[model samples]
Target: MSKVVLITGGSSGIGKAIGDYLSSRNYTVYGTSRNPDTIQNSLFPLLKMDVCNLESIESAISELIEATGKIDVLINNAGVGITGPIEETPTEEMKKAFDTNLYGPINVIKTVLPYMRSQKRGHIINITSIAGYMGLPYRGIYSATKSALEITIEAMRMETLQFGIKMTNVAPGDFATNIAAGRYHAPVLENSPYKEAYSSTLKMMNEHVDHGEDPSKMAKVVHQIIENENPKIHYKVGAPMQKFSIVLKRILPDKVYERMLLKHYGLK
Candidate 1:
């Protein structure tokens, strides 16, 4: 039988691209969205699910198992972006980002683990961000959320290994997607100290997304991870420089790296 794969936030963007590519390759693919009915002409079936809602996630997973008999792989691709100056961003907004981007994926994994454990074999691929490796000026909250998830997986991957289940994080750089439209952005107050820097950084961030690599590239990477018998704990997909930044952070001193980031964001 073809492997059964479940992807959250699959109605569009990277999730949709993965679903489409995997479906064409004969893997049974099911994507999730808050409103599956709203999506039309999706290459694979989409289940109604909200990662932030535990009940919804349980229901969707149960329904998927009932239909497919097994979930061979899961891609936790459901996440929201938040961009704002750390001090100016509302506490509530930051909590909301953590709720969706961090807690949301954890809850889904909690619900799916028992099933995967019973099967004694499965793969979990988390869709994190290249930004997760380090803090970005205006995108601090988003970075933190993904960074936390990356660390969580590092610990959980070991614990779950005994059950023959594999867990890994795939951090991708900016991809051409609708993520910018859905992300939260704290207003740039004209009088705020961060207004000038935040405004310019936000504009630059969007332009990067507008000219980002195709989501299909991310899909291909996901596919390769699924096929690998011993997937690494972390994999990054992006421009050479974007991937190199992670390495730079490792080899360079903290102050030097911070300065480099400041210059890159035009905040120096």
Candidate 2:
């Protein structure tokens, strides 16, 4: 029997790439997107779901479960990136970032855990980022959200192990995706003292993304993890740079690592 995989935020980027790859592998794939019109493949069933909306998430999952009877894999890949200095980031904007990036995934997992528990078998992959491990200058808010996700996935992994379910966190370092260009910008604050600093940081981030890895490569790692019977708790995508970053963060002092991150992104 073909595995049934459900991917949130599968409308585009890495999520879309994974959906496309899985379909090619003969998996019965279902993707959820806020904008169904933007989805590339019409052949796979695409449901309109906003991860920030609990009702929409539940309804979509319910419909899928009713139709397919099981979700062998769930990909919590939906997220948003907000760029700005910590001091300049508005309260509302911060809330929105957390809602979609952190809490939204938690809600989806809660709703799906029951079915997964009943089946006593499933895989949950949380799409995190290198930012989760090391904070960036203008991306503090975005990094925090992913950091929360990383911590949550760790705890969830320990709890779910005995249930015969698996949880893997995919932390891909700079992938060439719409994310760099599609950052959610907060309303410009006039008379803000740090505006210049934030602008310089955002510009550096943009330039770094211009030379990042392709999103399709990240998709293949996702496919490999899905097919593995005993997947690792974390899958770091991208080139050796990703592993190097993790190792550097682990061994370097706070100031040294911060400086390296700034220099790596041209913020130095």
Candidate 3:
């Protein structure tokens, strides 16, 4: 039997791409969205699930289990993007981001682990961001959320390995997706101290997304990871420089790296 795969936030964007690719390859794929009915012409079935809602996650997982009898893989791809100056961003919004990006995925993992454990074999691939490796100006909250998830997986992967379940993170760089459309943006108040700088950085961020690599590339990398016998703890997919930035951070001095980031963001 083909492996049964569950992907959260699969209505569109990267999740949809993955689902489409895997389905074509004969994997049993089901995706989750807040409103599955609204999505038309989906390549795979999408269950109604809000990662921030434990009840909904449980319901969706139960339904999938009932239908497939086993979940061979779980992809925690549901997340939101938040961009603003750390101080200027609303505390409530930041909490919401953490709830969806961090706690949300954790809850989904909690719900699926029992089944995966029972099967004694499964894979959990988290869709993290390359930005998680380093803090970027204006997009700090988004970075923190993904970074925390990355660290959490590092610890959880070790614990879950004993059950014959594998967990890994695939951090993708800017992908050409509708993420920018959904991201929360703190209004650019004319009088706010960060008005000019924040506005410029925000524009640059959107441009990067607009010209980002195809989401299909990310799907291909994920397919490879699922096929691997001994997958690494972390894998990054993006442009050469984007991936290299992570390495630069490791070798460069703290201040030097910070300076480079500042220059890159045109904040210097």
Q: How good is model 1 by TM-score?
A: 0.99
lDDT of 2 by residue, 120-162 (tens): 9999999998888877777889989999999998998899989
For each candidate, what TM-score against the reference?
A: 0.99, 0.93, 0.99
Candidate 2 Cα misplacement greater than 4 A, ranges: 37-40, 187-191, 265-268
Q: Report the C-alpha lDDT of model 1 over 147-168, residue by residue, as the tens digit.
A: 9999999999999999999999
Between candidates 2 and 3, which one is better according to lDDT? 3
Could you give candidate 3's per-residue lDDT for residues 1-268 as a string of tens digits? 9999999999899999999999999999999999999999999999999999999999999999999999999999999999999989999999999999999999999999999999999999999999999999999999999999999999999899999999999999999999999989898998999999999999999999999999999999999999999999999999999999999999999999999999998899
If ranked by lDDT, best first, what sequence of candidates would result?
3, 1, 2
Question: Any runs in candidate 1 off by more than 4 Å, and if so which?
Answer: none
Q: What is the C-alpha RMSD of each candidate to the true structure, in Å?
A: 0.6, 1.8, 0.5
The order of the candidates by TM-score, greatest first, is: 3, 1, 2
Worst 10 residues of 3 by lDDT: 182-191
